[model samples]
Target: MRSGNIFLKRNEVVFVVILSALLLVVFPMALDSFRLNLVGKYLTYAFVALGLVLCWGNAGILSLGQGIFFGLGGYGMAMFLKLEASSPEHTAIQSTPGIPDFMDWNQITELPAFWLPFHSLTLTIVAILVVPAVFAWIIGVAMFKRRVGGVYFAIITQAIAAILTILIVGQQGYTGGINGITDLRTLKGWDIRTDFAKEVLYFVNVALLLGCLLLAQFVRRSKYGRILVAIRDKEDRVRFSGYDVSNFKIFIFCFASVLAAIGGAMFTLQVGFMSPSFVGIVPSIEMVIYCAVGGRLSLFGAVYGTLFVNYAKTIFSESFPELWLFAMGALFIGVVMAFPNGLAGLWQAYAQPWFDRIGQRGAPRPISPAPISPTAAPAERRT
Candidate 1:
């Protein structure tokens, strides 16, 4: 039991090594700038998938509004970037030169109070982390304390996403409306539009993702993780045991929200925009699909799933715009029906075992019964 804390299992260690190599070494050397950038965008979604693995997959909480957290994070970062890009000099043509262009276009003379904090990069970063977490906490506390969960909670989250999207769109002066915050130029004084910057951001994103993975792994191996699993499988039993199941649920939910937010912020940096379109029901469902398709129970599967689904989406949409949706729906249906554990499950069930068999065949076997019997007899006499 104590050994769980000291090290990851050998397979986990190998998995991490392979993932690091692929992300850090192989992909960078192989993919061109455009493709690499696209992969980076997909990696951002992986963050949400990782969160789902912890919250929904482990804790048995299914949220259909993850896109809400993602959008908030992206918008928080985008607000700062937009503010920087909307400097007096940059927006000299506008009547309100210092305010965001959307505000100026809407005939607003003064910057709203809420947008003030975003001017400082430090504060923006803080907001990126705090806002979604706070929002999630409120939602979690309200729902979990009342024993609202499963499909009802999912529906509530979806409603929240829809409401938020409408609010952002309706309040054009504040949120950039349906268009979302765009024309993000730089972080501090450094330009982020260049290919060099994208490369740097990709590496930064990967480092953050790896750090999150380790943290998730630690959680999954901890005592709290066991309790959480117990709560998931038998909430009443855990509750009868005097454990505050609601608190655990809230904690995981908020943690998942933060993860989604971080991904959103990274998405904005890499994609250069945050739109209400992404904050709605569809994107949130898409994120869940990513988690599901990757094997929700597997952390590494989340990333692989996000990439696989997004790549499939892009490829299918490019070649067969009309049939892409149908194709995607069919693929999802097939995956759920045939391989409920997603790609990760498929790998574990078949690929990993196949590889293990090959390894066993190649390895020399030394556990002969005659040698073991002779050695055991001598050791038995000494005992």
Candidate 2:
């Protein structure tokens, strides 16, 4: 069994490496600027989906508040961008002095204390990880320690994301309100406005996505992964086996939060802005659907699912804006009803017959019933 697992792991690694090389080499050349940007966004979403797969797919925790983590990271990066954009020199040139547009519009004179730390790149990066980790830890301890599961946990997490959006919108002066923190000039001194810089951002997004995929794959094959799967299959059994199931859940939850935050930061940098709308309940649900439609246990499934669905959305929206949602809804229903394992699983199942055919070509066939007749002739005759 150990050897088999080792072989399987090697195969998985090879597959990932090959696919990554193919994507890096071919997609950029084939796709135009707009399509490449769209694909990059999808790749960012794939990172979020992979995180969800690690938690919900393997650990049996259907967290619906991943957007909160994503938002935290996005807002973290956005804050830094805003601060850099609003430096003493830039602020002097702007129409309004000593404040951003939203802050000025909202009649604000002083920057909030919390926004001060975001000025430093080091602090901002730390906040991006620490903020989401702390929040996930708190939430996980609160719910998992109490043994909350199923629909109840989902509802609570979804509510958390929902409330976050409202709070961010309500604090217009600090959080940019409904307009969001736009007019981002640079990311860590790289001018986001330039095509070359945008391309660099695109490559960064891909690298992060690949990194997340590899992390998820590693965790999925680790002892922790086995525990997660065991807990998913039989929580009581794992608990009875003397393992601290709640702690495992908490760990995976925190890990997923980190992944979401990373994805969010990449996404914000790519778009050159961040907004509450990007981290609302709708997006949270969409993230969940990405994992579901991709085949929850498959890391690459998450990537494929996000890319396929979002690409489809862009095309359908352009062609039929009024009915795009309806079309997407129908597509989701179709996927759920016809392919419970999702598109990736559907392809695997369909490909199995071909694989079997290939294997059969060189394998020896078993002899038919004639050999048994000598020993069983009397019994056969009696029968």
Candidate 3:
């Protein structure tokens, strides 16, 4: 099959089907509400990994500030939730009953102008989608147009992440400081904290993830995607071919940012909070590791990689908190050194071939007619 025509190849389709079944059926069935909710949170990170597969893996843009966009989206939703939770009835004892609790605690008497729109669910949803794209566009225009990339681009992005973290933490009154915009209780009058709500949100998260995956697959199989690969391999050649490479880079970067933002929003909904801890250098870099471990080039691998790494972290950190960092560092090193293409690469290299061989061996074979024409003719004559 032609390359683009086979975006969802037979094997890939099977993999996706099985993964969907596991995530949508098996996991929900097996895990308790708490564990399942945690899985939902991890799946949010998978969103960022999927974006990295496009921006970093395909286009060769390594952003170390994706958490910024994620935080933006999360904060957007959290703002609305905070507003709902801080209604006049809920915070009647506070000095500013209509404002968020953090604002009141910090001695603020009124809500900020920016926080006004968040009171409207429609506006909040729009902000969740638009804010990150706009921010990403600004960054992309500044960097890509100037031909800034490689380690320098990564450094700049990391700096942006750091700056955002500081701003969020420093503005204690406005942003809730280190505590972040927490105690998010409701979404348009629906109590998000309820177990039933969590289950519904998990399904919503999965559906959105699947939609994003399909979109990513479409982009990956497009002529635009090929151009991205070309730019990654040889920027000058693509530029020489009359393509405005920066435009493509900008668009993909913004696209990736939007995806991260959506994930962040979902994270807030599922986890019930948004914090600056998720908007800093460490989390941003960790997000990259997820893509790396999943096979940066593989979208499906990104999801599994995120789940596997997070699952390991949860188990190991609970048992050996002090050694968690060491384990993570070792895991990163092992992945880079031994399986550069990650779990997906490993499967493609070793497991897939073995599976194919096994399939071939186990396939039903056609049986030849016994004793040929002479024996059949004698039997017919006797009859």
Lowest lDDT 10-residue stretch of candidate 2:
1-10
**Displacement of the residue 30 alpha carbon in candidate 1, Å:** 1.2
Best of the two (2, 3) by lDDT: 3
Task: For candidate 1, give the lDDT of residue 26.
Answer: 94
Query: Tens digit of lDDT per residue, candidate 3, span 227-314?
Result: 9999999999999999999999999999999999999999999999999999999899889999999999999999999999999999
> lDDT of all the models against the reference?
0.91, 0.84, 0.93
CA RMSD of all predictions: 2.9, 6.2, 4.6
Over the stretch 1-383, how does candidate 1's per-residue lDDT look in tens digits? Answer: 12465357877888899999999999999998888888999999999999999988889999999999999999999999999999999999998799899999999999999999999989998999999999999999999999999899999999999999999999998899989898898999899898989999999999999998888888888888888889889999999999999999999899889999999999999988889998999899899999989998999999899989999999889988999767767877887898989989999998999989998999998985443444477767555
- Please give each candidate's TM-score: 0.94, 0.89, 0.93
- For candidate 2, write residues 1-383 as lDDT tens digits: 12242123644666577768756877888987766776777777777899989998899899888999999999999899888888767787545566666887777877778989998999999999999999999999999999998899999999999999999999988899988899999876778877677777788888878877877877887778988999999999999999999999999999999999988888888787899987888889888888879888788888888888898888888889999768767877877788867866876788757866888897899877544555677878566
Per lDDT, the best of the predicted structures is 3
How high a TM-score does candidate 1 get?
Answer: 0.94
Which candidate gets the maximum TM-score versus the true structure?
Answer: 1
Candidate numbers sorted by lDDT from highest down: 3, 1, 2
Superposed model 1: Cα runs more than 4 Å off = 1-6, 359-383
Off by over 4 Å in 3: 1-7, 358-383
